[model samples]
Target: MNFSITRLEDWQQVVDKILPQLQHPILLLKGNLGAGKTTFTQFLLKNLGSTDEVNSPTYSIVNEYTSPKGKIFHFDLYRLKDLDEVYDIGIEEYIDNAYLCIIEWPEVYEEELYGMKFHTMNIINSETAREISFE
Candidate 1:
């Protein structure tokens, strides 16, 4: 499914559309810079009942958020040049322990995550609005 999010408020509907179908618990967000991958993460975390702040993991690589449901690990793998880096960082542990894992720049390690039930969220934009598609 796809959604056209013109404003932040449109995200609530986007969340409603996607969250219920997230049985896989793993999401690969593919988007260009400023295309709203982080925004989708924020919605997911907030809906999971997390009160803590949600921030991008661009530099840190991973940020953990805890809620009553479970812990979510958000990862930005853009800086990783090879799949070996994922293992070096003990990222598999996070994937195993997290109730949800949302990864940006997952193309860097897509082959490693094969066989996992993962959903891909693609974000595209025009001059005005960001369109998000999930499958």
Candidate 2:
């Protein structure tokens, strides 16, 4: 499915549309820098009833959140040097136990992710709006 958002306030509507399609705990977000990936994630977490501040885990690699529904794991793998670093951080363990795992820059370890059942969203940014397509 595809969605276009012209403003931040419309993020919730996108989340609402996609919520029912989320059949798996893993979500792979693909986009360039400043393409609204984190913005969309913040909306998603909030919609899921999370009160904690949501930010990119660029340096930390992973950030955990407690929502009214359950635990959500947000991972930013942009800084990792290799796939081994993913193991070093015990990503598999988190994926195994998380209620939801939203990953950014997952292309860093694309091969490893092939075996997992994850929802993929690609965000395309324009001067006036952002387009999100889910697969």
Candidate 3:
């Protein structure tokens, strides 16, 4: 499915629409800088009952949040130089935990992620709106 968000408030509708289809534990977010990946993530976390602050894991690599359902691991692989760095940080361990794993810049480790089952969302941004397509 695809959705268009022309305002920040539209994020809630997108979140609501996608929440029911979250059969997989992993979510792979694809987009360019300023494409609202983090913004969409924050909305998702909030809708999941997370009261804590949600921010990009750009420097930290991963950020963990607690929701009413369980733990959520948000990962940003943008800074990793290679797949070795992902292993160094124990990404496999987290991926095996059966919790929600929201990943940004997953293209960085595309080969490693090939076997994993995840909900992929590609966000395309225009001058006044953002288009999100789920696959």
| C-alpha lDDT (0 to 100) for residue 78 of candidate 3 | 93
lDDT of 2 by residue, 1-135 (tens): 999899889888999999989998899999999988899999999888899999999989999999987889999999999989989999989988889999999987778877778899999999888988998
Candidate 2: list runs displaced more than 4 Å. none
Q: Which scores better on TM-score, 1 or 2?
A: 1
Looking at model 1, the pairs that clash are none
**In candidate 3, what are the lDDT values of residues 61-81, reduced to their tens digit?**
999999998889999999898
TM-score of each: 0.96, 0.95, 0.95
> What are the root-mean-square deviations of the candidates from the true structure over C-alphas?
0.9, 1.0, 1.1
Clashing residue pairs found in predicted model 2? none
Q: What is the lDDT of residue 49 in candidate 3?
A: 94
After TM-score superposition, the amount by which residue 26's alpha carbon in candidate 1 deviates from its true location, in angstroms, is: 0.9
Cα lDDT computed for each candidate against the true fold: 0.89, 0.91, 0.90
